[model samples]
Target: MATPVLDKVEAESAASPYITVTMRIRRFNPEVSDAVVWEDFQIEIDPKERVLDALHKIKWDVDGTLTFRRSCAHGICGSDAMRINGKNRLACKTLIKDINPEKPITVEAIKGLTVLKDLVVDMEPFFQAYRDVMPFLVTKGNEPTRERLQTAEDRERFDDTTKCILCAACTSSCPVFWNDGQYFGPAAIVNAHRFIFDSRDEAGEQRLEILNDKDGVWRCRTTFNCTDACPRGIEVTKAIQEVKRALITRRF
Candidate 1:
């Protein structure tokens, strides 16, 4: 009788009891350090563990002071969005197996925002810009007696922007936002596009005027970083381009 061959999973399970991963987390204490610093933590994590899980372990078992925000661990909350290995991603969604296992993963707060603690950043400005766009259905008359009826085609028009989770991932990854904090950023523009292009919205012209400013959608260079970093797979650049097209067409 021949011996049974073990698969990769079985081999890994038999060979190693646990996998050790080094996480180089960015540390900054506003009261203690004049600048940001890097702190490394070696964690014996399971192969199936996620980056967020490792972070939680470090916070719970290793360091009680390590800070990061998380609401839903399934990537829907978007509160745990950060820069991992210089790329924007949701910590809950990234798996240890997908990255360079041998090398240390660098985790930092999202760029273009004020870091409150280890991986937590203040997102007030990001939300303010979102509010500035007035991201809601504004009907001229009283509320409809029933739910606003619309065809599938109408819903599909703004479907791309509807995927946003208000994570600030798109806005933080934007270069224009980095240089100019006043810029509305990708997330805000994405939300504006949602209402502006909606068939049911009656504020297209007014919203377009708001986005016509220098720091509005005009600042977007179509870099596509926002789309790449988006966890929800939204077409951020496409929506920004559509808004630009509307602005130009309406002028003539």
Candidate 2:
């Protein structure tokens, strides 16, 4: 009958064939206690959606309390880097379909940092180490009116290190950084390499001295985790190795 046909159409409209992904997000409130906890959210998602989209849905529709950082919705912001399923990844770039869609996704703040709220971590220490490396180009003579001329080969020497976005992706993934806060970390060393190889920069010796400290480049054990975790595809381990070689070869 017409009634039966209408009922069938209504049922089809009401049912969704897509998968519902469950996310278990870690929650923390420093004002309440030092102990952090987890809260689970169930969201109906399209297979093509990224994890950042899922987080946006949870924050907007499911719970207003849930919090995280993201910008540029693309991977460039690097603000939403976190422990996604036990690995560091930019939330915007991580697609849900790529992961085990049937299983729940576990999201947590990046390790080796103090949680500020739900997902935000204090980045002061990370920036402090970044500043310690003297990231800017230092020249001896007066500023040239035009661009300093350099051969293509000179520019290529430090090309790999200049790709860093200051996202802290490499720094947070380092095992040495997780255990020792004093260590200069990979991001700092990468920045140092940017200028160390520059033909115009005259501060290589000074930068090498800074990196030669106990908590500096010597702390890196060459685990290559930083290189693996870097979203920009920088050769982090190689830069650190270059700095180590420079320290050993430098004439004091």
- The Cα local distance difference test for each model comes to 0.90, 0.89
* Model 1: residues with Cα > 4 Å off, grouped in runs: 1-17
What is the lDDT, from 0 to 100, of the residue 235 in candidate 1?
Answer: 89
TM-score, model 1 to reference = 0.94
| lDDT, residue 205, model 1 | 86
lDDT tens digits by residue: candidate 1, 124-175:
9999999999999887887889988889999999998998999998899999
Q: Would you give me the overall lDDT of model 2? A: 0.89
TM-score against native, each model = 0.94, 0.90
Q: Choose the strongest candidate by TM-score.
A: 1
Model 2, span 1-252: residue lDDT tens:
579889999998687756899998999988877899988899998867899999999999999888898888888766988888888888888899998878989999998988899889998999999899899888887889999999999999999998887778889999999996789889999999999999989998889989999999989989998998888889899999999988988854
Error of 2 at 116 (Å): 0.4
How much is the lDDT of residue 186 in candidate 1?
90
Pairs that clash in candidate 1: none
